[model samples]
Target: MAATAAGAFRRTPIERSDQRVAWDRTDQAFFAAGACHILAWVCRESYSDKTIEIVAVRLPGQPQVFHTYAAWDGWAFDHSGWNPEPQLLAVNADFEGQPLERLKITEGLAEFCQKHHHRTPDQYWHDPRPRARDYIGRYIPPWA
Candidate 1:
């Protein structure tokens, strides 16, 4: 089990190399998935300052999407001061009928971050909004 700053511990299965890139290059969009997974792990482990309220997704080829929500009760993060209901982080992409593949990528990214440090090189580790933006701008667009 891995330890987190909020005292939350969880175990994740390691991924194989083939499962890492199962999506087609043209229609596969794992940017948001990767971001959310990494952000969740980071928030749970290193920085428990601001709670991740919600993660909403609107994919291009999927009928039903996925959403994740978290709340702060003084032990972790409290973004309620900025917004009464807590702001959500939305991820728009096209899974291309490869939901399972997308999930693998997300999990892989989180595990990779947990084992390796990708956020340390970043200057804005404390801020999620900026870090998300930078990630999309720098990595997501290029991958797409």
Candidate 2:
């Protein structure tokens, strides 16, 4: 299901995100891979009823952030689809032996949000908007 949804995405051109992201590669199958912080913010605002929070992680000794996503109800959602949070964390932490620290509330995500997300912050400093929200439905499964 996640893969199917990912298939539907037309990858956003990542020029702006280059200044914000730290991930070594953005050629992953998930369209949001390059702009995870932006897409995650979109998902969080679009599904406010789910009480989703944006989250991110860093390499063990590196300050640079990576792999942003939305979390709620012990589950996590990204362009790839939804998965149990623990499983997702485990996979994200050690994918291809690129281990990372535990997920953290997206405190470090503000700069990305500020630059790319152009929505009313609600309470956030620079939450993103409509286009991201519009893109979200394609990834939401019925059970979710």
Candidate 3:
């Protein structure tokens, strides 16, 4: 299914997460790729599970941050936020509430980066740019 056609995935709010991210260099590369869809696609190709999803979210004013994780049983694994990296603003899983698709993610990312950042697919893919820091530096739990 198309990324746009897939509609919105249910937003899963993470109440608390550990302070440090124990990801290795390869894992960090995947998270970095979340900023650009082409890199995301490349990441998907390298991994064994093509079903893994990559999500990019942008707040009203902040630069977009990408979250690369797999959704299962209404939760995301290998997710980042409420920790070293920026807090995740939103997530799109696949259908049946899983908001992910390889083609759609890449296409949407390409369109968005080109229109907003004036970046071509190749430029965004090849360039070394800092990832988006945080959607909001502070976090207050829903129950709070």
Candidate 4:
């Protein structure tokens, strides 16, 4: 994930060609039956010195249908856990309902950070562990 200022993050919608874009956890539940878009982002929390990753799905033809998962441990989907903060979770739940042309990722991220700052950060960091290396290995050649 790219490094950035506090509360800054990157949003990427898994493309049709990306192998990983195929049906995954976000597609299992009834909430995502018509999901056509899967998006993810990575951000840093300066206040807690932690890194956070979020993955979300949008159901086509359903503007209000949104499901998201958050992970403070690492970038892998399995490591992600549901955000317990209702107010912040609501931001994600209602995100796709807004006008995409007018919605700014940065603005939405800032709002999320503002609402969830009160919670304690996750204690484990994956950056230094085997899971982190294994994930990177997916794209990096052994010789690299």
- Which candidate number has the best lDDT? 2
| Model 2 agreement with the true structure over 4-31: per-residue lDDT tens digits | 2222333336633442232333423333
- Give lDDT per model, in order: 0.28, 0.55, 0.32, 0.28
RMSD per candidate (Å) reads 14.6, 7.3, 14.4, 14.6
Model 3 lDDT per residue over 24-143, tens place: 223233333333344343333434343645444433344543333332223222323222111122224322243322222344545656644524434433332223222111222122
Kindly give the number of clashing pairs for every candidate. 0, 0, 6, 0
Between the candidate structures 2 and 4, which one is better when assessed by lDDT?
2
Clashing pairs in 4: none
Per-residue lDDT tens digits for candidate 4, residues 1-144, read 221111111223442233233223232221122121121232222113544445443344443323433334333221122223333333433553442211212334334434433111121121122332233234322122
- Cα-based TM-score, every candidate: 0.24, 0.60, 0.30, 0.21
Clashing pairs in 1: none
Worst lDDT window (10 residues) for model 1? 1-10
Ranking by lDDT: 2, 3, 4, 1
Q: Give the TM-score of candidate 4.
A: 0.21
Query: Among all windows of ten consecutive residues in candidate 4, which has the lowest summed lDDT?
Result: 2-11
* Residue ranges of candidate 1 with Cα displaced over 4 Å: 1-17, 22-30, 58-63, 66-144
Choose 1 or 4, whichever is better by lDDT: 4
